[model samples]
Target: MAEDPESGGEKTEDASSRKLGKARDEGQVAKSVEIPSVFVLMAGVAAMYAFAFYFYQNLMGVFQFNYNFQGVPDFTRLEAIRLLYVHTEKILMTCLPVFGAVYLTALLANFAQVGFVVSWKALEPKPSRLDPINGFKQKFTSRAVVEFLKTLIKVGVVCLVCYYAIKGELTEISRLYDNSTGAILLFILKVSFWIFIKVCLIMIVLAFLDYAYQKWKFLEDQKMTKKEVKDETKQTEGDPMVKSRIRQLQHEAARKRMMADVPEADVVVTNPTRLAVALKYDREEMDAPRVLAKGAGPIAANIRKIARENDVPLVEDKELARNLYSHVDIGKEVPVEYYQAVAELLAYVYGLKNK
Candidate 1:
């Protein structure tokens, strides 16, 4: 099919909710991986600081346990293996909480961004992913260029931050040789942890910028053309022509029913050529006269014709017909003001029958 240039070209319209929903279902959400990375890094650094004393105590205890194994100890294979396991357990005890906290932070960050969404569709393999031509286009696209620049900015910022942080700590490094092993270890931890905290804090600003840009871009990508919007609306709500046809059918059925009841009305009032209203009255069955049908133009003409064919009276009092057509409904009593006029008309009709 020949495509309309507008639909195939730039997308200026806002994305429809259906498009957004479909994208979400496909696991195409606007979220930065960097946001979670920053949070996880912060969590790890905070965990390190919180657990520092516990780590120091465990390491000291391990050192003491090794030292207290006085003098004549045999270095058997089983003893070496046992020592390895014990030390490994100690290392895990020192490190596990930080790792766990970082994992939880990553999960929490992801949850805050897109909530709970599991999509195997996103994981499905695509052959186009392996195509070199498509890959080249993807690699050189504007989005890819922005991603590269952002990465470059992050690296440059971190390096500058590291240089300044380390420059002030140069004298501290010189004192490490004279300091106790414990003091040196503590100094190293403090320096690394401080730099880590600074990097995470700085990265947070970049992450926010990236997240906002990604969201804007995602919505822009989802935008549709006028033609596409119309097509989608028709698909969901139904085509206008089909609806109009159904309405025509319904109107025809109603007209037939009204015509069937016209023969039973006591009188049909006409507004000369424009309007007609049929009124039926039965003393035994009703308290007052009720309108059976009313119509304007062609349908009014039909009502008048039906009344003539059935020998039903066609009274054409312009003011009275206009009032009845305008004020009274198809199956209701005339208003109080018109009661005198209607009573006189009915009396005249009865008098004529008596004559």
Candidate 2:
């Protein structure tokens, strides 16, 4: 059913499991980009800290090698290409592990947020996504406004953190000209690392807030209207009237099967009108007589009619019939207390058969 905004208005109902599942299948789930960005930044910085000595030595060697190079390798094209390749290779070898760690951290962060999700629908090209009108609406949406404000706050916070981090090291920065080249490099590295840590910490807090907001937006978008819930329920579970009719037909079919077994019964014990208990005994199969069938009201009348037509003997015992119907189930042995009463009825029915 089409959702008429003027009629029902906004969706106030909570999202159903089916709705959530459909949304997930379409790759619409709450996930924040900040989580992976934060993790990758953290991993890159941590890796740099852990491998600082190795990186510093290799970097120094590359700088020395570059400084000692003589006359651009005789100005040949092949030599020029070779020089470029060697420089690129050295840089890659030095930075490869750090880049790899950052990539791995991003993958793990995404996995933590939404595990092992693969949806082709998310990657499929949709015209709606390219629609300028829809894009404009989304850009001006309340959620977008909040996200933009959050981004501004994060940038401001990181800038403030960086300022404070460097504020303490102004004197060290001023004395950089007097220090040796290696000492100056080390000082710059330490100051940059301190600023990186401060910015990373501020972003971590912002990432958590962004993640929370993403989840809230996801739920709001997935909410269902009352008619939507009802229609979904009907689709998953058949219409009420149809279900009731099916149950009625099932009852009739079962009643017919029970009536067919009444002919095999040795006797029909009845409360005359309200209850009827039909029991059958097999010496080899049963330890005690079982209730082949029992019924009440109209069903009791049908059982009596079927028994009389089949020429089975009828015994009117109100107490015995009531006890059997109440305490015993169809296809189950009667209660122990009713065994004596049932035995006497069976003996009388057998005597009649013998005559």
Task: Indicate the worst ten consecutive residues by lDDT in candidate 2.
Answer: 1-10
TM-score of each: 0.85, 0.92
Each model's RMSD to truth, in Å? Answer: 3.5, 2.5
The runs of at least 3 residues in candidate 1 whose Cα sits more than 4 Å from the true structure, single-residue gaps closed, are: 1-7, 61-84, 282-288, 327-355
lDDT of each: 0.86, 0.87
Off by over 4 Å in 2: 1-9, 69-73
Q: Model 1 scores what on Cα lDDT? A: 0.86
Model 1 over residues 1-355: C-alpha lDDT tens digits?
2334967645667888888888889999988978998898899989989989887777777867787766877899999999999999988888898989999999999999999988888999999999999998999987899899999999998898889999999998987899866787788788888899889889999999999998888887777877788888999889999999999999899889888999998788787899988887788988888888889999999999999999888887778888988898767888889888888877766676672
Across 1-355, the per-residue lDDT of candidate 2 in tens digits comes to 3455843656888899898988888888889999998899899889888888877887777777878776655768997898799989889988988999998999999999988888999999989998999998999988889879988987798788878877888887888889876787677778778877888988898899999989988998788788788888889998888999999999989888888899999899998889999999888999999998899999999999999999988899999999999988888987788889999999999999993
